[model samples]
Target: MLLVFVLILIVVGLASGMLGSLVGIGGGMVIVPSLLYLGLFSISPLFSEVTPQVAVGTSLLVILVIGLSSTFAYLKQKTVDYKSGWMLFIGSGPGAIVGAWLNRFLSSEQFSLYFGIFIICIAILMMVRNYLKPVVIRKTFLYTAIGDNGDEVTYGYNVPVMLVISFSIGILAGLFGIGGGVLMVPVMILLFNFPTRIAVATSMLVIFLSAITGSITHMVLGNINWTYAGCLVVGAWFGAKIGAYLNNKLKAEYVLAIFRFVLLFVGIGLTIN
Candidate 1:
């Protein structure tokens, strides 16, 4: 029974890591809900004691693994915009701290209800992601990168606006244990004119940094389950690598379309449960 529980967690970690890396959302969207479901169903004695805070804390730790693994792969591909990633982290890091502190206030029912609503909203937003127009701004902080076709693509952002947006996303990340990439990726593409692939890669960097701060707070709060975290890390490490490789091969639009449906189904399930 112990072995079976461990295997179940590993498989959950693999799926969460693969999806998190592919989308840059930090796998918390899958992890938190999965842990909750397991606990709610009493799948194992270990999981039966799971709470929202514990689930979020455990998920954040796994997200750190996902972020590190994916970021390393993106670095080798030279797709990561390090400057932008660092700048975004400036806001997200502090916000993550605040969010982690706030998570202690929520009950399990509140957490589930809020998370379900958030996921549904994100799914709706993703449906219209491609249709949105990029906001045109003067190139104040310009960046140039080679596109998939080997053409030079230039992008830029307003630092103040970017910082503010990142801070808001960071709070949500800490509060929900998401990496905030679901929102950040679209914000980069639509508001900053970032290439899709670049946004996804760079988002991982920011997620990695924010997860560090968020997880630390959770750790201090005694929310983490080390045994569960260790099992998830083992699977997430390999899963992130596989996801990063596939990100280069697959069309993100198609992948996200499928993912949106999954989120919708999961969201509705959570809401009704």
Candidate 2:
């Protein structure tokens, strides 16, 4: 029975990591919903009583593992932007802690509803930006970074703008049990003028910080289920490597389209579930 459950977790992790690395949404969105469903179905006696908080905490641990796993691939490709990644990380840690603390006040249903709404809003915004007239810009060349495929990646960003985004997204990440890559990736591409690939890679690094910090808070709150997390993490490690490799072959537009679709799907499912 234990082996069967572990095998099931591995399959779930593989699918989550593949989609996460491809679109920068992170594994939490996948893990949370799936785990909840598994709990309802009594897939395992351990999962039969799984609560939203436990699922969220366990998901964060899995994402932390996935982020670390995927980051190695991004690093080898030189796709991870260390400087900008650190900047975002600096702002994310505190926000994540605050979000974790805030989570205690909201009921599980409230959290699910709010997160569902947030996901839908993000999906709509991504699609609208694609079709809408150019949003007015206040831009400055922030810095330069080298990408994996020898692309010259320039950073055109407003420091204040990015800082705010980093902090806010961190809060959302913690509150929703997501790693915030879904929001961060798009913001980096649209607002900072980063290439889609660079944004995806950078988002991994940011997620690393957000997930770890949030996981720590969840741990303190006794929210994490180590048995589930351990199984998920092992599979996520291998899956992340595979996902990162596949990401290199995809086009930017396709990645964005898939990301939007995933968001919409997750949002509606959470709301109705």
Candidate 3:
């Protein structure tokens, strides 16, 4: 059963990482929902009795690995930018530590309610943002919007705009034990009017900080299920590479369409389940 559970997570990790790489959503969204479906693990409370809080804590541990592998893979692609990514990390790190402690103070019901709220909004926002925009390739690179044609286009906005985005996304990410890429992706799209590819790559860069922040706090809480975490990382690494490759190969709509659906499914499933 333990091995089976690990296998399930590995598969989930691969799918989430690949989609995440292409869409800029991170693996934690999938991790939390799937873990909830899983109930809980070999801990003392048994599966059903283990509170949602504990499940979240455990999921954070696994997501840490998923986020790390994804981030590193994206970085190698030069998709992970250092300047904005670093600042975002600074803010997220402390937020994650504090949020984990706060969760410990909350009751199980409180945790579930908060989690539900977190899941719902992001889901709706993700679908709306992706669906409305037409995917175009551009060579904006670090500037903002992507340029598929030789006519390079860049958003007029600057780093401060991105800074605000980092902080807002960081808080929820800390609370939810996610990379916060869902929120980040849309913000990049609207705030900077960035293209899907840049948005996806940039979101992964931010995940490096956000997930690390959340994961460290979960670790301090001493709730990680390491066995599962290891398997998740192994699968996610390869998955991210494949996703990155596909990201370069596929059209923007192809990735975003699937990405949006995954978020929708995850968001609704978490709320209803």
Instruction: Name the best candidate (by TM-score).
Output: 1
Candidate 2 C-alpha lDDT tens digits along 1-273: 667877888888887787777667677878887777666656565656567788888888899888988998989988787888888887787788888778777776776788788889988987886664433457654667664457886666676777888999888888778888878887787777676678888899889878989999999999888878877887888888888998887664675687778879988987876
Q: By how many angstroms RMSD does model 2 differ from the true structure?
A: 2.6
Clashes of each: 0, 0, 6
Candidate 2, residue 49: Cα displacement in angstroms equals 1.9
Task: TM-score winner between 2 and 3, please give it.
Answer: 2
User: What's the distance in Å from true for residue 157, model 1?
Assistant: 0.9
| Candidate 1 accuracy as lDDT | 0.88
In the range 132-215, model 3's lDDT, one tens digit per residue, is: 653343322345433545456664235554455576667667666677777777766666565556667767776766666676
Tell me the spans in candidate 1 whose CA falls farther than 4 Å from its real position. Answer: 41-45, 148-150
- Model 1 lDDT at residue 209: 94
| TM-score: model 2 vs. ground truth | 0.89
Work out the TM-score per prediction: 0.95, 0.89, 0.80
Clash-forming residue pairs, model 3 = 137-147, 137-148, 138-146, 138-147, 138-148, 139-147
Better of 1 and 2 by TM-score: 1
